[model samples]
Target: MHPENGLPENSPTTRVFVALAPPDPAKDELARALGPAYAAYPRMRWNRIEDWHLTLAFLGEQPVAAVDLLRAPLAELAASRAPLSFALTGGGHFDERVLWSGIEGDLEALQLLAEEVRALVREAGIAFPERRLRPHLTLARTRRDDPASVVEVAASLSGFAGTAWRAARLHLVASNFGRGPGPIRYRDVASWAFRDPAAGGHSR
Candidate 1:
């Protein structure tokens, strides 16, 4: 199934991703850090703090039955790696429509995670999207006419450095796209803990 957001019935319905979520304290810190920038671009759709996550892989719509099959590998992966710490820095837009914050620090770890997730998807026989890994946390969406504001907003956010937080859990979020003005509601369908580092690829 595809992710819950904007999917048709009878088709894969879940839009899935392997992600790193900030702890509560980090979320609070990010909200506090971004409050002013949020006001500067009043028209942009700023994502809610609770929905902030660093996505490692985006598994577009898939059949529901595959969720369990997908989870098994991710759980094993999580159990091996230690929680990663990363910092947010700068902002940019994708075709003037999507606004996102650049990620830094521990980037090697993030890259490794992406590679591991890609391998797992292949082993599961999932049709993986052909795209390079460009790590960034999407923060807002900009309207056409108001795109100029995002450019300035990105520059203003150039120095934002939120506190590093644990990446202890990987959430399988279900998104409801195209029907809400607020942040997409995400729920954990399954989770796996970090296994001992000595377990080869599974280790932190």
Candidate 2:
């Protein structure tokens, strides 16, 4: 959200996305597995545990009113679907600079859901860059000086296989990306249950 007159020039646009966060139990499980890497990769800028999430659609910046058109449609899409079963499996690096944990199980369903979200965004007249979905939880960022650290860390986690968990909520989130100097923080604009409570389905 932006306030005219009192905010920066770019305030009129907000950075937003659609995503799903793992429940505390699932996140905790991954955290435990990475305990050793935490100390070994001290220079890496680790993301806070609470901020971990898998983005379904990255809808960069847009007029706040344009996003409003998506509210009802997204809720309806989520309600028509059921929760997906997923597990954190292994690890990887992007350009050897970003470390992430992989996602597996129900992958076809996950891809279909993401495609639907992108389509809904288009229907709302929202435009965004198209990137192939590589499902993962971004764990940290490595520095240019020591790109090899992330590779070692990724190798160590190659055998990790976390317990399966249900993904039940679809969240529309806004991020404080260019607003100030600090770690990026995210807040949910709104969230909807994937399965409707009206027919014996519930949130996790």
Candidate 3:
């Protein structure tokens, strides 16, 4: 169990897996491409485009203190792995509620990154949620009446194709702040390079 954040040993804090995010232009392009669809479903709580990221894994809540122990190995993993190049293609919905854009290019690299992050988390004795990594950028969330709107949005962006972007670093972020009654904010507590310069290959 990790240490808790001054919460009388019972407050819930979410633990998640995060990776380096795409550049601003890439994210903005996706947002612009998705704007019309979002206009159609005003009720949906669309995630701000600035929050788009490529998640490598999702580690459930843990004692907050455990992060220090986990950071070293995670940094090493990042230093050993090479960067990845990818593009955005198409749009879809999750359980008819959450809307997202699909990712293309270098998917194999993404899978490898997920596996490495999972192994590192396990090595630190942290309990992680079991779920396959589905790499996609979340765009918006829907309400009960959102199914039809979601379908329409999905059909409209069926042919989206964005320019490719390269990923160079891995970031450990905090999501507790900027979530409500204000703009959402994500803080990167730590980050490391995608690969070791000497080896000319991604870390194993």
Candidate 4:
């Protein structure tokens, strides 16, 4: 059994999630909109641009061996799905603790994709909580004492809208957070491109 959660302790484990990330240009557009927030809420914990992603399935703390079981199935799923078109638009907050940017366009397709992803994880024998899909990219978090900061910042982003972009890849990522005192870091364990027939069955 694992020392932390007692699932299985044969090998080390990492917290994992499957997600779709906005392209660099799209992320840059959102970053520009956040400039004022950055200055006003300097104490808030802002997520790095590179770490911003729309999580499809959160498979928290899985043994490395269990995580490896997901690779092939996820790749095949990605190969069958078409790219999704979406844009960053507006913003919101969750209980004034978290700040997030909302997503717009092709929402039906996005929901379908998320459902399929969660199904795939289940088929791989990975157990995770099932939560309703709320399409948003987490931007930052405010301290418990500074509740108003997120509310104000979210209001500032009310009218912000970014250019639409194709989400072409599905990323299986791992984060190192609780294991150490250093800043949390996210890295891809594997990624698969959406199959585009016009692009010769490859991602552009």
Tens digits of per-residue lDDT for model 2 on 1-204? 334322124546677888988999999998998999998888888888988899999988776777667889999988888888899989999999999999998888889999999999988878898888889999988888999999999998899999999888998877777766555677777788888545775533
How well does candidate 3 match the true structure, expressed as C-alpha RMSD? 4.2
What's the lDDT of the predicted structure labeled candidate 2? 0.84
Per-residue error for 68 in candidate 2, Å, reads: 2.2
What TM-score fits each model?
A: 0.83, 0.88, 0.83, 0.90
How many residue pairs clash (N, CA or C atoms closer than 3 angstroms) in each of the candidate models, in the order given? 25, 0, 9, 0
- List model 4 lDDT by residue over 130-190, tens digit each: 8888999999888889999999999999999999999989998888757665446777888
Q: Which regions of candidate 3 deviate over 4 angstroms?
A: 1-14, 177-185, 196-204
Ten-residue region with minimum lDDT total, candidate 2:
1-10
Q: For model 3, where is the 10-residue window of minimal lDDT? A: 1-10
User: What overall lDDT, based on C-alpha atoms, would model 4 receive against the true structure?
Assistant: 0.87
- lDDT score for residue 113 of model 4: 89
Clashing residue pairs in candidate 4, if any?
none
lDDT for position 88 in model 4: 98
**Taking the tens digit of each residue's C-alpha lDDT, what string does model 3 give over 1-204?**
223322213534545456668888888888888878767777776766666777787665556567556778988877777778999889888888767789998998789788888888888888878789898887766667657777678778899999999887897765643236543345565677777455676355
Candidate whose TM-score is highest: 4
lDDT to native, each model = 0.72, 0.84, 0.73, 0.87
Whole-structure CA lDDT of model 3 = 0.73
Tens digit of per-residue lDDT, candidate 1, span 1-204: 225422334655566666777778867766776788777777777777778888877776666667567777887777767877777777787887777888877888889888988889888988857577898888887777887877777777777787765577766665655546765565556666665445556354
The TM-score, computed over Cα atoms with residue i paired to residue i, of candidate 2 is 0.88
Query: Candidate 1, 133: how far from true, in Å?
Result: 1.3
